[model samples]
Target: MAVVAIDKKDLLAFVGKALDDGELARLVTDLGMPVEKITESEVQVDITPNRPDMFSAEGLGRAISSLAGIKTGLRNYSATDSGVSVSVERSVKKVRPYIAAAIARNVKMDDALVKSLVALQEKLHDTLGRRRRKVAIGFTDFNKLKPPFTYKAVKPDESPFIPLGQSEPWTPARILKELKQGQDYGYILEGHGQYPLICDSEGNVIALPPIITAEMVKITPSTRDVFIDVTGTSQHAVHECLKIICCALADRGAQIQSVNINYGKKTLTTPDLSPLKTMLPIRTVNKILGMDFTTEQIKEYLERMGHGVEIKEKGKLSVVSPTYRNDIFQEIDLAEDVAIAFGYNNFEPILPQFSSIGKRSPSDVRAGLIRDLMIGFGFTEVLAPYITNRATNFEKPMLGEHPAIHIKNPLTENFTMFRSWCIPSLLEILAASKDQKMPQKIFEVGHAAILVDGKPVEQEKLAAAICDPKTSFNEMRSIVEGVAYELGLKLEFAGLDSHPTFIPGRAVEIIMDGKPIGVFGEIHPQVLNNFGIEQPVTAFELKLA
Candidate 1:
């Protein structure tokens, strides 16, 4: 969360009328602003990350008007096909695939607009596009640039251009050093042999993706119209960047122009905007919130959100959402919008319409009993993160043949895989406590991952481990059976099973209700050595059913 101080005078001007104290408070709350205090002159607002569009006063004002029904029509940005052109070359296809551009004409450039543009670009770069590695945007003064701009990849030493904030023309590699944006932000593509650069047909460099642009065409207050370019490796990402930039420019009252790019045999256009139809079920709205509103009330709420609701023969409302609302893909989303428009505070907080008592499941009850039993047996409970390293999750000997869910975009390697079992994590805790004296008894009651029919299924289980010089497999099994008996759970012991991470003759599987729930084993000397554990260890697990 970030707190941005919106000028009170500026906000009032955009708000269009003086708001009373309660009305202002409702306006702030309706716009989802966490207003700490409201004074006679200014207001302090807290903004959330998801609503980057609300960072600007224009966006916030528009949202307030839409909710208040002051504005009931959809706003569209008209694309002006008059100025600027960008051409993609074949050389950059393998390095960066897609590019999109729009021309913003007659933009009233000022200090506030410039600061807002720069801040919006940086925020979008970091949040939506991962700091422009996935997508990058470039803004150039249209008056200075020649027609038909070329976006291509060339030799680092062969091209030279004056980067933004620099006084002299430098080669691609040298520009990385002079601009100071290359080493810090350019490192994303530094390992590649060739860099992604954009230039005009006359070999004049424009920009390096995820880095700075040339100063020759920098946007200034004197500039009236500008050319905006977005480049990325993914076509979908490039289109999203275009939408973000197009919307931001439209806020400044810019007339957008769709640019055509030649990609081998295919020709693509910028800002390929489309309108989508979202259906809202009249019955669903009534059921979810227990609202007694008729279909007419629902239709009015939809209209308030800049949507045209048409009642079909089936009695469902067909709400047409503007193309800018790419997030509304489901009926629940439409219901949420209706709720917002209806006013969250207006809804009465009452008991459930249908009387149904909440109760714990059988598995939950058994798991709780096991946890309490373990605590009574002089065992301390420990809870570890559900995400763990691959080395501890899969490389350990006592591990089972279960697939772990991997994070696609993990921030660190340690959180790569979801934990399949709690036993391996317990071993890590034991290793960390090696310096302490003997008689270490620990227990964990948590969820574990298991693969059933090729899909992951999470199950609740309880595990206990005792580390001492004299700990044995039978001792751990006795504790498990005792806990199961106290919970009125029947347990069956299977034959010794061979596991990669466990001693061959010392391991047995625990079965409950004809389902194999857990395993009990003594720490193998070789496995103990692998974990740097010198003392004997015993562990057991039981699934709560």
Candidate 2:
């Protein structure tokens, strides 16, 4: 959640009328942004992360007006062709690849407006922008910039400009060394040879983005027209943030003009403000809210909550949500809007009819018992993340390319897939703690997944490892035998050979019900070298159920 302070006067001005203190609090609360405090000059509200639109006074006021029945339904925002364009060069493709831009003409700027805009920009950067990792927003005085613009990349030392609040020009390398923002976000471009830059036709730098904008085009009280630029790694987030800012400026009476973004091969216009169309089933509304609402009542509630609704079929309505509303995704989201419009406080509370207590399942009980047994055996339990990289889970363990679940768009190289077994994770623990004392005994009771016939099958697994100069395969085998005896089960150990992850002559497989259920062995010297573990290591892994 993001807490924002809106100037009371500015809020009411965008609200289109005066609202008393009580009315203001109640209205904002009804609109889902709970008022933190209502003071004479400002109103503080906690806006949910999902509603990035409400981070600004203008957007919050628009929502208040809608809930107050002053102005409701879908707000139509149109953009005229500004005849200005930005050329996106291929050099930035491996850096910050996407850029979305627009021009808001006839913007009436003031001290309050300037502060609000700055606050909105920073709020967006901290929240929706993922601290500028995914998105970054920049604004400038439109008249100060000479277009068409170039959004490209350059060597860090090639271009130099005065960043915002700085008087002297500094190269991108120097800025990252001296500026606070650069210090906080320079890691985003740490290993890159070039940095993302936006400049005008005259070779004047506009921004070193995800960091700071140039000072030459700073917005001021006297600034009339505003130029907006959003750059990011995610194309969807960049475009959505552009639409949000453009719509907010439009609410302040600015005329939004679209700018063409030219990729090497194609051109596209930005700030697409067309409302997204989706179907909202009437029965879904009734089912979720547990209230009998007729089709007309539902439509009215939707419109009151700022949605354009039209009867579609026998039981569905075609809903058009405002472009600035990034929260609506499905019929259930529309249903939530209807509930908000109907007033959540109006719903009567009732006791649930069913009577049953919640308790852990039998599998959980067994897992807990095993964890206790490991702790009693003087082994510290280590919980590792299920998502591990291929190198650590497969390559380093000397089990090359075994099937497991893979993440489609992994955020980083370290987290790419689910572990197929617990031994690799236990080895990871020992690898990270190599500097600790000689004796390290650890255990993990978790789930591991493997692909069976191209489908994932997951099972609970228990793995334990002992790392020391004196540890041996017999020690791990003894611990496994103790666990089996505690569980009142008979197990047979069979000599195993040529296992890739274990020493060929020192491994044994445990058999139960005439089938091999587990293995305990001295880890292979090659595997130990892969993980940089110098001491001898013995480990065992088995299915719990």
Candidate 3:
């Protein structure tokens, strides 16, 4: 989601209506843009990243007006050919290949409109433009430029222009280092021997894009005609952005003109404002919405949402979305548009089929009994968090041969890994309570995820630790034996040589019914030192499975 801030005055003008804050919020929400916060002067709306057309005041205002009945049906915009041609050089194919340009004439300019244009360009660059990596936009004063432009790959020092926000001219290489916009977006062109450069017929630089535009031909409130160029590695993205800009300006009463894009021997005109037709499944819409809407009614709803709909009586709708819109693809998209136009608040709520039953299972009973048994053994039950770091989870290289599970993108390093064993947490509890008393005995019965066959397998275990100067391997073994006997399990212990977290000869594998359950041992000196615990620790863990 992207947040778009619109001046109330500008939005109201484009909407062709003056709305109170509450009404405006409700109206925009029904138009597929969720309102964030609306004041009397500004509206901050959460624009879905997919709806770049809805990311601007004019683009969304057009849709909103139609949905609110202030405006309706498809708006036919007119454009005249500017006869401007931008030649594509073969060297740019490996750099920034595609270039689609357009001219918007008779644009009614004002300070609010200028700011809106800037905001719309930034939103496109951040979202569908992919931070200018896949696409970048360039806007210039149309009257100041000559016809027949050239988009080519040039050496950084070969093309120099006064970049926007700067007074002096700068080379593309220097701009990447000295200019903040360049420094932030410089990585996109790293290691490239040549950079993308756009210029007019007389070789006056238009822009050094995916970076910054020229200051000489910048847009202002007085600029009536606007020239827009979209250059990138992807032809689709470049065309998509160009269409969005052209339509947004057209909504403001500007004429769109296509620019001839010369690619070696072939030529193509840009900013194709023609609507793309798609099939809308009426059956899927009815089934998903749980309401049978007639084709005419659905058409009305789609029209109100700014879409052109034609019903073929073939179980699907012949749908057409505006050129500025790129998010509509599947049946669900039409259903959503219909729902939005139908008003989400108007839908009747229905409760689910059945309520979930709340009851304790056998595992809960066993866990409760084990918890009580540990308390009965004079050990305090402690609870710990499930998320932990690597050092705390696997000091002994973990789960025999398998590594412990770790989070892919943790918000903080403190919660970077999953717990593979409970003994480490028990030791941490002792270290935190070291200042309290001479002897600290704690136990925990919790779930841990251990790696098995290269995948994390979650299992429940009962782990207890006695941290005291006199605690020994015998004490830990007796505690485990007593707990197993109380649980009605015949337990046997076999000597385990060379354990990582325990003394080599003092550890033994706890087995029951010929299956190894866990290990009990005197905590190794190195392990105790790693956790900063001075007391000798003896611990035992048992698999509840």
By TM-score, the best candidate is 2
Candidate 1, 509-532: lDDT as tens digits:
888778888888887777677677
Cα deviation at 96, candidate 1, in Å, is 4.7
lDDT of 1 at 251: 69
In angstroms, how far off is 274's CA in candidate 1? 3.7
TM-score of each: 0.74, 0.77, 0.66
TM-score of 2: 0.77
Model 3 TM: 0.66
> What does candidate 3's lDDT look like per residue over 1-545, in tens digits?
78999988888888888888888888987776788897878889998767788777898788878888888767665557778889988889888899998898898887777888889998888777767887899889999898788888888787788999888889999999889989999888888999989888889998888898899999887888899999887788788888888888888878889889999789888877778688888888998898889888898999997888887777778888777778777788879889989988889898766899889999999999999999999999999887888867775323243487887534344576888778888988887888878678899999889778897899899999999899998888889988988999899999997788888899999999999989999988888888888889999988898
For model 3, the stretches where C-alpha displacement exceeds 4 angstroms are: 165-168, 314-316, 351-545
Off by over 4 Å in 2: 16-35, 348-365, 368-484, 488-545
Worst 10 residues of 2 by lDDT: 407-416
Ranking of all predicted structures according to lDDT, beginning with the best and ending with the worst: 2, 3, 1
Q: State which candidate, 1 or 3, has the greater lDDT.
A: 3
lDDT of 2 by residue, 106-154 (tens): 9889777787888898888877787788789999999999999999999
Count of backbone collisions within predicted model 2: 0
Q: In candidate 2, residue 288 scores what lDDT?
A: 88
